[model samples]
Target chain A: MTQLVRVQSFSVSSDGFGSGEGQSLERPFGSLDPADLHAWAFATASWVGRREPGGSRGLDDYFSRDFSNGIGAEIMGRNKFGPQRGPWQDLSWQGWWGDDPPFHTPVFVLTHHLRPSFSLTDTTFHFLDASPEEALATAKQAANGGDVRIGGGVATVREFLAAGLVDVLHIAVVPITAGRGERLWDSPDELLDRYHLEKVPSVSGVVHHLFWRD
Target chain B: MTQLVRVQSFSVSSDGFGSGEGQSLERPFGSLDPADLHAWAFATASWVGRREPGGSRGLDDYFSRDFSNGIGAEIMGRNKFGPQRGPWQDLSWQGWWGDDPPFHTPVFVLTHHLRPSFSLTDTTFHFLDASPEEALATAKQAANGGDVRIGGGVATVREFLAAGLVDVLHIAVVPITAGRGERLWDSPDELLDRYHLEKVPSVSGVVHHLFWRD
Candidate 1:
C-alpha cells in the first residue's frame, strides 16, 4: 500500500500564521497565548493529555479524534520538538509532551544537529539531518506501509508542501490572529494548481480547510 | 431609523489580503488576477454586468444578490475607485467600472486630493477628505435611513473596522492567496471581543465569515 503523507488538524491563525514568534521555555506558542490558538482542540475530548473528562463532542471533537486515526510514523520540525535552538544544550530535554507522548508510532525529528535514537513509551524519537525527500524516505520506511504525518511548526509544513510531498493537509483556521510569526505560505494559491482545496466550517467558529492530491 | 454599515460580497485571499501589491489600471488586483479572487462571484448569476446569463444559483449567488439590497450609499477608498495616486491628472478618469457602475447608490470616495462630485448613471461619486467617523457620518446622511456599504480595498475596511463603524461585515475567503498586498486587519481577534463571528463554508470552496454587532 502507498503511504499517505498527511497533515491532520494543524492549527493556523486567520492571518495564516501557524505559530507565533519568540518561542521560549515559558511560552510554547511564543508570544501568543496557547488558549487562543488551541481552544477548539482543548475543548475536544480527543486532545492529548486532556485535563478533564467532559468536553465538547461536536465538529471540533470529530476532527481531534481523527488526529491519530492511521498514523504509523510522525515527522516534526525541530521547534515542535523543543525550544532549544542550535545544538541541544542538555540531553535531558525530551519533549513538551512529558514522558508518554501522544504518538504511539516512531517519531522523526528533523534537526541539523543529530542525536542518538531514544524511546519513551511506544514512541521513539529519531533525529535526522536530511532534505525533505531524504527525510520522507526514512519516515516512509519507518511508517511500515501506514501513513506518515507531517506534524508542523510552519516552516516544516512549508518545506514539504513546496516539495509536493504532502498528499493531504488539514488546516484548522482559528479566528485569532497572530500579529507576528512564521507564516505557512507566502500565497496559498501556489498550491491550487497541484492540489484540490475544500473548505468546511465547523460550529465552533473555526473553518477547516482541506487540501488533497489525487 | 438608524443607518447600518456593512461589507457585502467582499472577497479575500486565504492570507487575508483583499488586493495584491502595486495595484494599477492594467493590473487592477496587482500581481494577482481578478478571476482567481472573484471566480466564486463570477460563477454566480447575481454578478453585476455578468456577460453570460447562466451561472450557479447557489449560496454564492445569494450573497452576490445581497450586495445591492437596501444599500443607499457606499464608502470606498480611492484605490477601489481607480489607481491614480497623488492628484488626478486626467479629469476624464471616472472609475474602473465603465458607463454604469454596479453601485447605483451614492458612492463616497475617500481621498486626500478631493474633486468635484461626478455622476455615472444612477451612481454619484462624492469625494471626501475625512476620518472614518466623519466619512460614516456623511455617508449615513446620504444613505437616507438605508444601510451604507463599506466597499473595500483592504485599507478602507481596516479603517472602518478599527474605528468600530462597521455593523455587519461579510468576507468571502477564497482558497487562493494574494502573496502580497494590503491586509484587512492585522488580527481579526480584536473584533471577537466586541462582535459575534460566524463561519459558513460554501460548496464553491469559499468560506464566508460574518461579523455582526448585536
Candidate 2:
C-alpha cells in the first residue's frame, strides 16, 4: 500500500475555528476550551487520558482507538508543540504532552526558528525549517512504509492541505462555536473540489467530516 | 398550550450562511442554492413540490411532515416573498410561489415599501413595515390559537433571532458551505444562554439543530 498523508481525530468547532485566539501554555486552544470541544473523544475507551474503566463504544471509540494506527510519524506546527514563539527561549522546555507523549514514532515540528532535536520516552522531536513538501519528505522517510499523520495547530494543517499533500482528513466538528479563533475552513466545501467528503455524526453529538482524495 | 413563535425547517450551510451573496430574481439565495440546501426536505414525502409517489420516510420526512403542524401564519422578510426590493414598482407580481402559495394562511411580508394586501388561493399577503416584535405580535393574532412561523431570508432570521422573539428554532446544517452571503450565527453556542438545544443527525446526512425556549 502507498504511504498516505492523513489527518485523524482533529477537532474543530461548528463555526470552523480550529483553535481559539490567544493560545498559551495554560490555554492550549485559547478562548475555545478544547476540553469542551473534545468531550466526545474524552468519553471514548481509547482516549490517552482515560484513567477510569468503561468508556464509550462504537463510532467515537473506533476513531479514538484508530488514532495511532497505520501511521508512523507526525508533522505539526510550532504552536502545537508549545506556546513559545520567535526563537526557542528555553532549551529545557519540551512538548505539552508531558512525560509519555502520545506519538510513539518520530515527530516533526515546523518552525522558522530551529532547535536541536530531543527524545522523550518512545517519541523523538525534530524541529525543521522547511517547506511543506520538504517537511513531508522528511516525515515520510521516518514513517518508512507506514503512513504519515498531519497533526495540527490549524495553520500547519492549512499549509499542508493547501499544498495538496493531505490524502485523507478526518475532522470531528463539535457543536459549539468559538466566536474568535483561526478558522480551519471558510467552508468545508472548499475541499470538495478535490476530495470526496463523508460526514458521519457520532452518538456523542460530534459530526466527523471525513475527506479523501482518490 | 403556549402559542410558539418558531423557525421551522430553516436551512443553513456548514459555515453558517443562510444564503449566498448577490441575491436577485433569478437567484433567490444568491450563490447558495436553497434547492441543494433543502434536498433532504425535498426528498421527503411531505415536500410541497412532490408530484409522483415514493419519498424517503425517516427523520427528514418527520421534519417535512411537521412543517405546517401548528403554523397558522407566516412572517417573512421581503426577500423571501420575492426578489423585488426598495419601493415595489411591480404591483402585478404576486410572489415567486405562483398562484397557490404553500402558506395557506395570513402571510405578513416585512418591508418598508408597503403594497396593498392581496389573496392567492388560501393565503393572504400583508405588507408591513414593523419591528420583529410588532410583526410577530400581529402574526400571533392572525394565527388565532395556532403557532406563528418566522419564515426567513437570512437577515430576517438574524433579526428575529437577535431580538429574542423566537421560541423554537430548527436549523438544518447542510455539509456544503456557501463562503459568502448572510450568516445566521457566528456560532450556534451564542443562543445557549436562552435556549436548550438538541442536534439530531439524520440518515440523509442533514443534522437538524433544534433549539427551544423553556
> Model 1 over residues B149-201: C-alpha lDDT tens digits?
99988889888888888877778889987778877765556578977676677
Off by over 4 Å in 1: B1-214
Q: Per-prediction count of colliding residue pairs?
A: 0, 0
Task: Score residue B35 of candidate 1 by CA lDDT.
Answer: 91
Residue lDDT tens for model 2, A62-179: 4675677678899999999999889888889797988889898999999999989988998999999999999999999999888899999899999999999998788999999887
Docking class of 1: incorrect
- Model 1 residue B8 CA deviation (Å) reads 38
Error of 1 at A56 (Å): 1.8
Q: Write the per-residue lDDT of candidate 1 for residues A1-214, one digit (tens) a residue.
A: 3567989889888888888889998888797787888888997755765866655534465467567756789999999899998888788888887889988899999999998889999999999999999999999998888889999878999999888899877788889888798888655566789876766678877887767665
- Candidate 1 chain A lowest-lDDT run of ten: A53-62
DockQ of each: 0.03, 0.01
| Candidate 2 residue spans exceeding 4 A from truth | B1-214
